[model samples]
Target: MSDTAPKQRPQYRNISVPQILSYRLPLAAKASILHRVSGALLFLCLPLVILPLFALSVSSPESFASLRSYVDNPFCKLIVLALIWGYMHHFCAGIRYLCLDLQMGNDKHSAKKSATAVFAVSLVLTAIFGLKLFGVW
Candidate 1:
Protein backbone atom coordinates (compact mmCIF):
# COMPACT_ATOMS: atom_id res chain seq x y z
CA MET A 1 0.00 0.00 0.00
CA SER A 2 1.19 3.55 -0.91
CA ASP A 3 1.78 5.81 2.03
CA THR A 4 0.58 8.84 0.10
CA ALA A 5 -1.76 9.66 -2.79
CA PRO A 6 -0.60 9.33 -6.41
CA LYS A 7 1.92 11.95 -7.59
CA GLN A 8 0.40 15.42 -8.38
CA ARG A 9 1.15 17.46 -11.51
CA PRO A 10 1.90 21.16 -11.79
CA GLN A 11 -0.37 23.47 -13.84
CA TYR A 12 0.82 25.87 -16.49
CA ARG A 13 -0.76 29.23 -17.44
CA ASN A 14 -1.06 31.04 -20.77
CA ILE A 15 -0.06 34.69 -21.15
CA SER A 16 -0.79 37.43 -23.70
CA VAL A 17 0.65 40.89 -24.43
CA PRO A 18 -1.41 44.01 -25.22
CA GLN A 19 -1.18 45.72 -28.57
CA ILE A 20 0.70 49.04 -28.55
CA LEU A 21 0.10 52.14 -30.69
CA SER A 22 2.97 53.47 -32.78
CA TYR A 23 3.91 55.86 -35.56
CA ARG A 24 3.52 53.01 -38.03
CA LEU A 25 0.38 51.24 -39.22
CA PRO A 26 -0.44 49.60 -42.54
CA LEU A 27 -1.23 51.67 -45.65
CA ALA A 28 -4.64 50.07 -46.00
CA ALA A 29 -5.47 51.29 -42.51
CA LYS A 30 -4.57 54.90 -43.29
CA ALA A 31 -6.39 54.84 -46.60
CA SER A 32 -9.51 53.39 -45.00
CA ILE A 33 -9.74 56.22 -42.46
CA LEU A 34 -9.15 58.90 -45.09
CA HIS A 35 -11.83 57.48 -47.39
CA ARG A 36 -14.61 57.60 -44.77
CA VAL A 37 -13.69 61.16 -43.70
CA SER A 38 -13.54 62.51 -47.23
CA GLY A 39 -16.86 60.85 -48.07
CA ALA A 40 -18.44 62.62 -45.12
CA LEU A 41 -17.21 66.03 -46.29
CA LEU A 42 -18.42 65.44 -49.85
CA PHE A 43 -21.81 64.33 -48.55
CA LEU A 44 -22.20 67.45 -46.43
CA CYS A 45 -21.43 69.68 -49.41
CA LEU A 46 -24.57 68.62 -51.28
CA PRO A 47 -28.07 70.21 -51.43
CA LEU A 48 -28.06 73.69 -49.88
CA VAL A 49 -24.31 73.99 -50.01
CA ILE A 50 -24.44 73.66 -53.78
CA LEU A 51 -27.40 76.03 -54.22
CA PRO A 52 -25.14 79.02 -54.84
CA LEU A 53 -23.48 77.24 -57.71
CA PHE A 54 -26.84 76.30 -59.26
CA ALA A 55 -28.07 79.87 -58.93
CA LEU A 56 -25.07 81.11 -60.81
CA SER A 57 -25.75 78.64 -63.60
CA VAL A 58 -29.51 79.05 -64.35
CA SER A 59 -30.50 82.53 -63.21
CA SER A 60 -30.86 85.50 -65.61
CA PRO A 61 -27.93 87.79 -66.22
CA GLU A 62 -28.80 90.14 -63.39
CA SER A 63 -29.41 87.32 -60.92
CA PHE A 64 -26.29 85.52 -62.07
CA ALA A 65 -24.38 88.75 -61.70
CA SER A 66 -25.53 89.07 -58.11
CA LEU A 67 -24.59 85.47 -57.37
CA ARG A 68 -21.18 86.12 -58.88
CA SER A 69 -20.67 89.23 -56.82
CA TYR A 70 -21.36 87.24 -53.68
CA VAL A 71 -19.13 84.28 -54.51
CA ASP A 72 -16.41 86.49 -55.83
CA ASN A 73 -15.92 87.93 -52.36
CA PRO A 74 -12.74 86.72 -50.64
CA PHE A 75 -14.50 84.84 -47.85
CA CYS A 76 -17.04 83.18 -50.14
CA LYS A 77 -14.32 82.25 -52.63
CA LEU A 78 -12.29 80.66 -49.86
CA ILE A 79 -15.21 78.51 -48.73
CA VAL A 80 -15.94 77.34 -52.26
CA LEU A 81 -12.27 76.60 -52.79
CA ALA A 82 -12.27 74.40 -49.68
CA LEU A 83 -15.28 72.49 -50.93
CA ILE A 84 -13.48 71.88 -54.19
CA TRP A 85 -10.51 70.49 -52.28
CA GLY A 86 -12.76 68.16 -50.29
CA TYR A 87 -14.30 66.75 -53.46
CA MET A 88 -11.00 66.16 -55.20
CA HIS A 89 -9.31 64.72 -52.12
CA HIS A 90 -12.15 62.27 -51.57
CA PHE A 91 -12.12 61.23 -55.21
CA CYS A 92 -8.39 60.66 -55.30
CA ALA A 93 -8.35 58.82 -51.99
CA GLY A 94 -11.05 56.51 -53.33
CA ILE A 95 -8.90 55.70 -56.32
CA ARG A 96 -5.89 55.08 -54.11
CA TYR A 97 -7.85 52.54 -52.12
CA LEU A 98 -9.01 50.89 -55.33
CA CYS A 99 -5.44 50.43 -56.42
CA LEU A 100 -4.68 48.75 -53.10
CA ASP A 101 -7.66 46.41 -53.59
CA LEU A 102 -6.22 45.36 -56.93
CA GLN A 103 -3.04 44.33 -55.04
CA MET A 104 -1.12 47.14 -56.69
CA GLY A 105 1.23 49.24 -54.54
CA ASN A 106 0.30 47.03 -51.59
CA ASP A 107 3.83 46.89 -50.24
CA LYS A 108 4.64 49.17 -47.32
CA HIS A 109 7.03 51.39 -49.29
CA SER A 110 4.95 51.68 -52.43
CA ALA A 111 1.81 52.30 -50.40
CA LYS A 112 3.31 55.33 -48.69
CA LYS A 113 4.54 56.64 -52.03
CA SER A 114 1.11 56.38 -53.59
CA ALA A 115 -0.60 57.96 -50.60
CA THR A 116 1.57 61.07 -50.96
CA ALA A 117 0.94 61.10 -54.68
CA VAL A 118 -2.81 61.01 -54.03
CA PHE A 119 -2.70 64.23 -51.98
CA ALA A 120 -0.46 65.98 -54.49
CA VAL A 121 -2.83 65.13 -57.31
CA SER A 122 -5.79 66.30 -55.26
CA LEU A 123 -4.14 69.67 -54.59
CA VAL A 124 -3.38 70.22 -58.25
CA LEU A 125 -6.90 69.32 -59.32
CA THR A 126 -8.40 71.57 -56.66
CA ALA A 127 -6.29 74.52 -57.80
CA ILE A 128 -7.21 73.98 -61.44
CA PHE A 129 -10.92 73.72 -60.67
CA GLY A 130 -10.85 76.87 -58.54
CA LEU A 131 -9.13 78.76 -61.34
CA LYS A 132 -11.75 77.60 -63.79
CA LEU A 133 -14.51 78.63 -61.44
CA PHE A 134 -13.44 82.31 -61.17
CA GLY A 135 -12.48 82.53 -64.86
CA VAL A 136 -8.80 82.70 -64.01
CA TRP A 137 -8.13 79.86 -66.46
Candidate 2:
Protein backbone atom coordinates (compact mmCIF):
# COMPACT_ATOMS: atom_id res chain seq x y z
CA MET A 1 0.00 0.00 0.00
CA SER A 2 1.97 2.98 -1.29
CA ASP A 3 0.71 6.35 -2.52
CA THR A 4 2.23 7.72 -5.70
CA ALA A 5 2.12 11.44 -6.55
CA PRO A 6 3.50 13.33 -9.58
CA LYS A 7 6.61 15.33 -8.84
CA GLN A 8 6.39 19.03 -9.65
CA ARG A 9 8.85 20.39 -12.12
CA PRO A 10 10.21 23.89 -11.74
CA GLN A 11 8.85 26.35 -14.25
CA TYR A 12 11.14 28.64 -16.15
CA ARG A 13 10.02 32.16 -16.99
CA ASN A 14 11.07 34.08 -20.06
CA ILE A 15 12.95 37.26 -19.38
CA SER A 16 11.29 40.46 -20.49
CA VAL A 17 13.02 43.05 -22.64
CA PRO A 18 13.72 45.28 -19.66
CA GLN A 19 15.12 42.33 -17.75
CA ILE A 20 17.75 41.73 -20.42
CA LEU A 21 19.81 44.66 -19.17
CA SER A 22 20.33 42.96 -15.84
CA TYR A 23 20.93 39.50 -17.25
CA ARG A 24 24.50 38.27 -17.07
CA LEU A 25 25.21 36.37 -20.25
CA PRO A 26 28.13 34.00 -20.52
CA LEU A 27 31.35 35.24 -22.16
CA ALA A 28 30.87 33.10 -25.25
CA ALA A 29 27.33 34.37 -25.69
CA LYS A 30 28.49 37.95 -25.31
CA ALA A 31 31.25 37.41 -27.86
CA SER A 32 28.84 35.80 -30.29
CA ILE A 33 26.41 38.68 -29.92
CA LEU A 34 29.13 41.23 -30.52
CA HIS A 35 30.34 39.28 -33.52
CA ARG A 36 26.94 39.61 -35.12
CA VAL A 37 26.79 43.29 -34.21
CA SER A 38 30.21 43.97 -35.67
CA GLY A 39 29.35 42.10 -38.85
CA ALA A 40 26.16 44.11 -39.21
CA LEU A 41 28.01 47.35 -38.60
CA LEU A 42 30.61 46.46 -41.22
CA PHE A 43 27.92 45.53 -43.69
CA LEU A 44 26.03 48.75 -43.15
CA CYS A 45 29.08 50.97 -43.23
CA LEU A 46 30.69 49.40 -46.29
CA PRO A 47 28.30 50.98 -48.76
CA LEU A 48 27.24 53.98 -46.75
CA VAL A 49 30.47 55.30 -45.26
CA ILE A 50 33.52 53.32 -46.35
CA LEU A 51 32.85 53.14 -50.09
CA PRO A 52 32.02 56.79 -50.44
CA LEU A 53 35.05 57.86 -48.48
CA PHE A 54 37.27 55.48 -50.42
CA ALA A 55 35.92 56.62 -53.77
CA LEU A 56 36.39 60.23 -52.77
CA SER A 57 39.92 59.65 -51.57
CA VAL A 58 41.05 57.90 -54.73
CA SER A 59 39.09 59.94 -57.27
CA SER A 60 41.52 62.86 -57.53
CA PRO A 61 44.33 64.60 -55.75
CA GLU A 62 41.99 67.36 -54.67
CA SER A 63 39.47 64.82 -53.43
CA PHE A 64 42.22 63.00 -51.58
CA ALA A 65 43.28 66.23 -49.87
CA SER A 66 39.67 67.01 -49.09
CA LEU A 67 39.21 63.59 -47.59
CA ARG A 68 42.35 64.06 -45.56
CA SER A 69 41.12 67.37 -44.26
CA TYR A 70 37.76 65.91 -43.34
CA VAL A 71 39.39 63.04 -41.51
CA ASP A 72 41.64 65.45 -39.62
CA ASN A 73 38.66 66.37 -37.46
CA PRO A 74 38.57 64.66 -34.07
CA PHE A 75 34.98 63.52 -34.61
CA CYS A 76 35.84 61.86 -37.89
CA LYS A 77 38.87 60.30 -36.27
CA LEU A 78 36.64 58.79 -33.60
CA ILE A 79 34.30 57.45 -36.26
CA VAL A 80 37.22 55.86 -38.08
CA LEU A 81 38.39 54.44 -34.76
CA ALA A 82 34.98 52.88 -34.29
CA LEU A 83 35.18 51.38 -37.76
CA ILE A 84 38.63 50.02 -36.99
CA TRP A 85 37.30 48.45 -33.83
CA GLY A 86 34.42 46.93 -35.75
CA TYR A 87 36.78 45.41 -38.30
CA MET A 88 39.16 44.13 -35.67
CA HIS A 89 36.45 42.56 -33.57
CA HIS A 90 34.80 41.03 -36.58
CA PHE A 91 38.07 39.54 -37.79
CA CYS A 92 38.98 38.10 -34.41
CA ALA A 93 35.50 36.74 -33.80
CA GLY A 94 35.42 35.32 -37.31
CA ILE A 95 38.57 33.36 -36.55
CA ARG A 96 37.07 32.17 -33.32
CA TYR A 97 33.99 30.98 -35.17
CA LEU A 98 36.10 29.23 -37.77
CA CYS A 99 37.87 27.41 -35.00
CA LEU A 100 34.51 26.48 -33.53
CA ASP A 101 33.33 25.16 -36.85
CA LEU A 102 36.41 22.97 -36.99
CA GLN A 103 35.46 21.54 -33.57
CA MET A 104 38.31 23.32 -31.85
CA GLY A 105 37.60 24.79 -28.44
CA ASN A 106 34.27 23.01 -28.29
CA ASP A 107 34.33 22.38 -24.55
CA LYS A 108 32.86 24.85 -22.08
CA HIS A 109 36.18 25.96 -20.58
CA SER A 110 37.90 26.16 -23.96
CA ALA A 111 34.98 28.09 -25.39
CA LYS A 112 35.14 30.58 -22.54
CA LYS A 113 38.88 30.98 -22.96
CA SER A 114 38.58 31.42 -26.71
CA ALA A 115 35.84 33.99 -26.25
CA THR A 116 38.05 35.90 -23.84
CA ALA A 117 40.94 35.63 -26.24
CA VAL A 118 38.75 37.00 -29.03
CA PHE A 119 37.84 40.07 -26.99
CA ALA A 120 41.37 40.67 -25.77
CA VAL A 121 43.01 40.19 -29.16
CA SER A 122 40.41 42.30 -30.93
CA LEU A 123 40.74 45.14 -28.43
CA VAL A 124 44.50 44.99 -28.56
CA LEU A 125 44.53 45.07 -32.35
CA THR A 126 42.03 47.90 -32.37
CA ALA A 127 44.15 49.83 -29.92
CA ILE A 128 47.23 49.38 -32.08
CA PHE A 129 45.39 50.55 -35.19
CA GLY A 130 43.78 53.38 -33.27
CA LEU A 131 47.16 54.59 -32.14
CA LYS A 132 48.39 54.53 -35.74
CA LEU A 133 45.24 56.33 -36.91
CA PHE A 134 45.75 58.97 -34.24
CA GLY A 135 49.36 59.42 -35.40
CA VAL A 136 50.68 58.24 -32.07
CA TRP A 137 54.27 57.05 -32.23
Query: What C-alpha lDDT values do all the predictions have?
Result: 0.78, 0.94
At residue 126, give the lDDT of candidate 1.
89
- Candidate 2: worst 10 consecutive residues by lDDT? 1-10
lDDT by residue for model 2 (1-137), tens? 33676777956498778877877999999999999999999999999999999999999999999999999899999999999999999999999999999999999999999999999999999999999889997
Error of 2 at 26 (Å): 0.8
The digit string of per-residue lDDT tens for model 1 on 1-137 reads: 58697787945364334323433666546656766787887687776578657866687888878888888788888888888888888889888888888999888888888888877898899889989877786
**TM-score of each candidate structure, all chains considered together:** 0.67, 0.88
TM-score of 1: 0.67
Q: Which candidate number has the best TM-score?
A: 2
Clashing pairs in model 1, backbone N/Cα/C closer than 3 A: none
Candidate 1 lDDT: 0.78
